[model samples]
Target: MLDHDTAPTGDKTIETAEDLSSIAFGFMASKALFAGLHVDLFSALADGPKTAEDLAKAIGVPLNRIVMLTTALASVGLLTIGDDKKIENSPAAQNFLSKQSKYDFGDYLRYQIDQQMYPFLLQLNAVMKDDLSEDAIASYKHWMTDEEQASVYSESQHAGSLGPGRTLARKVDLAKATSLLDVGGGTGAMTISLCKEYPELHATIIDFPNVAEIGWRFISEAGLVDRVRYIPGNAVEVQWPGNQDAILMSYLMSGVPGDDVEGLLRKAYEALAPGGRLMVHDFMVEEDRRGPALAALWQLQHMAFTPEARSLSVGWLTEAGRKIGFAIDDVDALIPAMTKLVVFSKPA
Candidate 1:
């Protein structure tokens, strides 16, 4: 009897099947990570390995649930179960996931990815069926309008942006820049990073009122309060401080309507002094909008929420800047294949 369900592939069958399964059940992996982060499991294991029973008691979860979660976490290689039946964080997990680690991004994973993005992704099918143009779930405007939501959004984004901000600080030379205008700089992650790197540089971060309030706290925490200032208002409508040595617009364009991006670029052009630099950092896709899989997936995720959101291509941005009296200086990947930094300068 021939089995209709199983298709015969020669040597590649196992690999192909595994790949397909990984894609199909990918949410399970994401959820597992989210769960582990939510419970601060890595932090609990930071001191040493612990038996599942010990972890359950420490975290106040049932032993059975902890056992199941540890199994899942081990499967994902975040932690490992040793011969002594104790689970310990993988080196990567200890370094990046533990709350005690300076590089911890667990909050980012929890708030941004798990809380904010995951719910909207659940409605991908409904969004497709309705041909939704605006956010079918939680709109960006609605989120920014609420005080609590805005704070949560800004803080989460700040946590996620810190790594890229550090990378940008290292890669981009801001030694010559004295003043910088950070447009829609939620929570001032980039500003804090750049200001910390350049003693002479001072930054003005413009964002909505609520988000700006949070940015103030972060700036104060970074001890860059003397160097960084907040300008609270709608970025598009506000009068941007002019004659700036540098302007940074990171992760802003893709959230707004496509038509507004060119206008914003024009604004950035006018705000810069002669020879002043402008940097646009965001998730950019290729002109064909094919896979660089992360950018493609991120674009779809944006579509699931923001109606005006679409992935901007580097080609489009370069042309747009040229038209606005700016010259392309450099294009570098801030996070390889995921986000990019496209730099332009006003002719001196």
Candidate 2:
């Protein structure tokens, strides 16, 4: 027992266990939201408040399940129980969770939670025991081999990337660059955003054939078909186009085998014109690899598929680029605390 008023501060100070508990039980909150989104519960609440019975009828779930779900959602701040005893979408849910909302991310969450990550995470123990061999689980490439799965994977990634894509567009200056090489650019989300920002720019996206088909559709829908083109191939082995003034590799590095990341950077270096800029944006851990909680978790998620998957560090990238003759230009968070953009320029 210690007196708080006279307790010695420093590292010896006792902290509440709530932080640990919160982390331990995080999946509950996640699954609650997943369940709500799964049946379009938020969409049903978009019009107005409804009794749990009404929600059950709307989504075809049991009344008692709806009652429990709405309660859990309210606990998670995604829903609210009004004095009238009706359940309603919280402002956050109405704006971003509802399927009718323009910023709806339900599909993204569905694809990530229901289709991909949730299943992968359940095998964490086995993955940790092995070296994350291919036998443990299917790699991203394996999943993408199926056309429908590729489309779903691409669209989900597009939804999540669009916001950060806009953020990156605002942060980087591309006014002078006329052409860009979007390596492993799925669905052309970033390229579409950037090209929209700079009307004079043109971009070529390189991805697997299935993914490129989906990307072409997205670019066409953006009315950027003429400015953005797709080239189908594995970026790691394909010959890069050398005429580009800028190259972007967003959310790509961590998926590359750890030993090959440098080789990939070297390829990007060789493909750039004099003074061309190269931007690598992905989830990166701290130099000491202690924690950026989500990024560390994501790195583990990557490990469940790829044997060599590991999060890159900003410090490592900066020094690696320097050795490859790329002058470091900027390193900034694109989606603060989750993803970072490391920019390097090839000297003339």
Candidate 3:
């Protein structure tokens, strides 16, 4: 009975049942996409269109089931039906989902979401209730203790980071920076990007030993062995090398225990020379703590592993940095709406 003037402000109303249904049924769509990636469906269709029967044979599914699978994918716009009624990948699927494409991120999606985050997300209710057992909580450090698990996680993370690293490199100006420190730098993605941009830059990455091993492979492949090196230790516990021109901490803040946040900031502060820039790129909730759904969900995901993980806000981080003698330089988006890069500079 409420008209526009009588409606509650800032309250969402269900205009149609479809909106609620879409939200409820969202998981099925995600699972369908994951199922497609599992069988390398996009890669099979990379060359051209194929008959459903051919896809069945290629993906080892029967014709009936293959049709159903393709139907699900097509409904989600990841696949399409041709004029000839053959199945094919859509433009987006062909570009980033196909294995033949250099921009392929299928493995990162499969490994991180399907294998890791999906499992943790199931425990979100338990996390919210604060009833998760100590044994049940598996932090990143615990996973790093197992070599195979660490390698699998780090490899996919490295793949995921490369594009963002390139994006960050484009966004931030590091033309004058020579010595750079990348704290908790997974596989040296940020370092590689920065070094590639500034040829005169030499960088050091600090991360877990297992992660450092994987990082070396990536650095070596990039052919920057001479300019980049890894200092293998926990970034919070290690003796960080000093007098850096810039320090980049991408995706580190939200992953650490709540108590360590300020200490880590202080460490970065002390480690930098006067006028050095410290860049923090992570998922930060809005100052009002309202829902920017993806960033909030990512912060919740961190709690699945690190139970003591704290949600960050730009206001809080800026205030914290100011308390440590850092002046705010800039705040900008790193991953569109999901992540932000906050730059702070130590006064000369």
Candidate 4:
């Protein structure tokens, strides 16, 4: 199974079977990961390593389940079991997934499993039916409303704990970045970070009306009302608000599928002033599909919805952006995180 997981495209039959296996066990893997995250297993291990028996007692999981979790984590390269049966985070885990790590993904996983996945599971049939159930509608509205804004803001801000956004944000000369556009910047996490970095930078945040109300309050509380404008509208039909020196695209593309993804990027490209950059931040896969367990698992989540829209490769993105006349530059794996940042620029 390990060999098969690492295999590239040599055997078509094996490749097809592996692909199916990945999809088949994808849910199981996701549940295991979320379970580990929920119980603070990674954080406990972060202080140092321990035996699964020790960990089981520490986290209060049964010994059987701890063994199962360890086996699954080891298979995914997120944990290592020594000869004496002590367990520790693999380098990947130490860097990106441990709750104590500065670049931790615990909050992001919590958001997905607790908020999005749980609710999405309940509304799956409705979503498939082209239906919007009243429960889902009410949950969404309530989530975005003023009363729950703090929870929304906390979740959104910490949700990027797994993002590659910080690296992309650093590579650019923000001094020249006067006007920026953050389309669908949930609760203004990315927006606030950029605003703080570039004193001259002003930003427009576009999100759902109720969500934008939360964002407005946040930008105001941060004393950035003068620098950030909240614009409430549907990202799908809204015209691209122009004159941005750079467009922040942090973790914003995966939820959009196929043509909509392309359309959104096209709009963003056109919205940029000449020489402006589109800072794409996401769990980008490697050129050759192999294990970067979190990213591979994330690809499954992407595929769960639209078959055509899986976690994309930065290499593929480069080629695609080139076709659109943008120059792809400074692609890098954001350390201490799961994703990669690929900065694409339109010529001056």
| TM-scores, one per candidate | 0.91, 0.91, 0.92, 0.66
lDDT of 2 by residue, 203-293 (tens): 9999999999888888989999789888898888788888689999997888767877898899999989898999999887776566566
State each model's C-alpha RMSD to the native.
7.3, 5.8, 5.0, 6.6
Local lDDT at 54 for model 2: 90
Which residue pairs collide, candidate 1? Answer: none
Best by TM-score: 3
Using lDDT as the measure, name the better of candidate 1 and candidate 3: 3
lDDT of 1 at 262: 92
Worst 10 residues of 2 by lDDT: 1-10
Q: Give, for candidate 4, the lowest lDDT window spanning 10 residues.
A: 1-10
Better of 1 and 3 by TM-score: 3
* Per-model CA lDDT versus the true structure: 0.85, 0.84, 0.87, 0.69
Lowest-scoring 10 consecutive residues by lDDT in candidate 3?
A: 1-10
In model 3, which runs have C-alpha deviations exceeding 4 angstroms? 1-17
Cα displacement (angstroms), candidate 2, residue 105, comes to 1.4
List ranges where model 1 is wrong by over 4 Å.
Answer: 1-17, 129-139
lDDT of 3: 0.87
Q: Residue 24, candidate 3: how far off, in angstroms?
A: 2.6
lDDT per residue as tens, model 4, 1-348: 011122342224445877899877777776777778878788879988899889999999999999988899888877899999999988777876786787786767666565565444554455556565554432322444454543544464545632434444565667887998888776787777777778898999887686776667668877898898877866656777886788877656665565666677788889999989887777766667764656765655544443445467776776778888888766766642356666778789
